[model samples]
Target: MGFRLPGTRRASFATKVASSKSCEVPKGYLAVYVGEKMKRFVIPISYLNQSSFQELLSQVEEEYGYDHPMGALTIPCREDVFLNVTSSFNRC
Candidate 1:
């Protein structure tokens, strides 16, 4: 089975994008913006502890310091690469 975050609820992509308000992250999750289009994804806060994810955070820090123009955590990578990295977490 795929690894699912404890409090995650499966939402259709369109529903997720449409339903998610600009600042409405749930209690156990945080929102991140990714890719050139700045698509938003709500992910478990636990991901912050993953080394690979931390590396991505580091990249963001280097590129944007403490001032993210999007006013949220923004990952500076292609959507496919971000998906590949996070998907690997499911296999562990």
Candidate 2:
């Protein structure tokens, strides 16, 4: 089954945060699309508190301004860079 990334249909973040496994976000994590193809990654919620990760969120906010077609938080960055940041978070 394809992982269901949030889309632009509506503001689902609040709903996703409240629901359980059936909501596609799993638990304590979120799905984001990275790279040109919009690749998807389900990342831990703790990553939100990291400065490096927050940088990416800022970029997303700047570009999308809470509205885009991808349904998921889109990170406009090289896959390697995204992976490197996330890998460090995994280590912590």
Candidate 3:
């Protein structure tokens, strides 16, 4: 699987909150990509506050024929991971 980093085209909210240092999803959540079958899937890292990881899993199941999304998960504050995340998405 390939890890796509968020870029300058990321969501406006994300871009504003993202400092020059790194990017972090508000509320401690992170987004990641996982490969299933022959395609890649986007999933929030750790777990969403109210959206629970299970919900994402269910979406993945319905869309990708898989019940789980897997990939390297890293929290905010980690410069490397943050940078990777920032480079993955597009900014408005």
Q: Which has the higher lDDT value, candidate number 1 or candidate number 2? A: 1
Candidate with more favorable, higher TM-score: 1 or 3: 1
TM-score of each candidate structure, all chains considered together: 0.74, 0.65, 0.24
The whole-model lDDT of each prediction reads 0.70, 0.65, 0.37
Rank the models by lDDT, top first.
Answer: 1, 2, 3
Q: What is the lDDT of candidate 2?
A: 0.65
lDDT per residue for candidate 2 within 1-92, as digits (tens), equals 12222342332443343333443776778777778877667766778998989988898798768775777677878777887776665342
Highest lDDT against the true fold, candidate: 1
Question: For model 1, how does the per-residue alpha-carbon lDDT over 1-92 read when each residue is reduced to its tens digit?
Answer: 12244344433442464247667777777778888988778777778888999998888788878776888888878877877676566453
Q: Give every collision pair in model 1.
A: none
